[model samples]
Target: MTIKKLVEQIEAKKSFLCVGLDVDLEKIPTHLLEEEDPMFAFNKAIIDSTHHLAVAYKPNTAFYEAYGLQGWRSLERTIEYLNERHPDIFTIADAKRGDIGNTSTRYAKAFFEDLQFDSVTVAPYMGKDSVEPFLAFENKITILLALTSNAGAFDFQTRSLEDQELYKQVLQTSLNWENAHNLMYVVGATKAEYLADIRAIVPDHFLLVPGVGAQGGDLEAVCRYGLNKQVGLLINSSRGIIYASQGRDFAEAAAASALSLRTQMQQILDAR
Candidate 1:
């Protein structure tokens, strides 16, 4: 999906919520295990229940990769279902991939052409060569990791090099790359305070923020500094929403959890 269409869905739904489908078999409802593909069954139920309350769905690749071939197939089926049934909603493959040029291009083709994800999260540690391959794809978004929600981010992301934080340098430098207009960023909601500075640098790009709810990142604080003219933020919630219940009403419970966040998002937009 294009940014214009994504923004339109946000406006129409009164939400910019991105539901993280980071499914873990051990944590899902046990009843779903009876299905041939438990993971896909769980995802389908959640999507069917909460599609109206979100503009995007992100499935972190590690979750699928951990389950081996079964997990990989589940991931495929999930994306295929979304593309065929909910094409209007954005899909992100949170694969955090980065490699040398040739390898990166193959990774890009796998996600952008084969799986058909609208966007994919990428690591920028390898710099321009590793990332531009993903950016080269027309209409597909390359969401680069900037300041993240993880505790270890301070190890390097905030480190000053020549008196400038590394992540700031990343944000500024990435803007000069080829097809930079297709760039979005991964800025953790836990790093909300730095968002004003982040916005000062890339005010127009969308930010995929993933530290709210279960991670305790304040939604109001994130929006106070993260919102741009286009409401450039995709606040993500994973375990908090999907694991709201492990009972038979799990899907309904997920919808309620998502609705709670979406209602708050609507209020934020309305007040703005």
Candidate 2:
């Protein structure tokens, strides 16, 4: 999906919520484990229940990869199910993949071609060459890990080099690349104060913000500084939504959680 399409969906739905599918088999309801493919079964239920409330669904690859081949198959099936049933919903493979040169191309093809994800999170630590390969694909976005939501982010991202924080340098440098408009960023909502400065650097690009809800990042603060004319934000809520219940009505509980976020998002859009 193009960024235009993504923004359109955000407007049409009156939401900018991106539901994170960080499914842990151990944490999912035990009843789902009885299914032949528990991971996919759980994901299908979540998607079916919350599709109307979300503009995007991000499946964090580590959740599936942890189970080896069955996990990969489940991931593939889940992506296929979404594409077939809910093509309008933006899909993100939260693989955080980046490698040197040719290898990066293969990784790009695997997700953008084989699995057909609309975007993939990429680590820009390897510099431009490693990330540029993912940008070669049309309408497929490279969500560069900038200021992340984790505690580890301060170890390097906040370090000043050449009189600017390293992540700020990344935002500025990435804009100069070819097809850079196809790029979005992973900005932790926890760093809400920096959003205004980050916006000054790349005002138009969409920001895939994690750290809301369970992580306690304030949604109102994120919008106040991060939002642009196009509603340039995809606020994700994973555990807070997907794990809202551990009972047979898990999907309904998930939907309710998603609806709560969507309701807040609609209010934000209206205020804007």
TM-score to native of every candidate shown: 0.98, 0.98
TM-score of 1: 0.98
lDDT of 1 by residue, 83-167 (tens): 9999999999999999999999999999999999999999999999999999999899999999998989999999999969999
Question: Which pairs clash in model 2?
Answer: none
User: Among all windows of ten consecutive residues in candidate 1, which has the lowest summed lDDT?
Assistant: 211-220
Best prediction by lDDT = 1
Q: What's the residue-level lDDT of 167 in candidate 1?
A: 97
Error of 1 at 152 (Å): 0.6
Over 4 Å off, model 2: 214-217
Would you list the clashing residue pairs of candidate 1? none
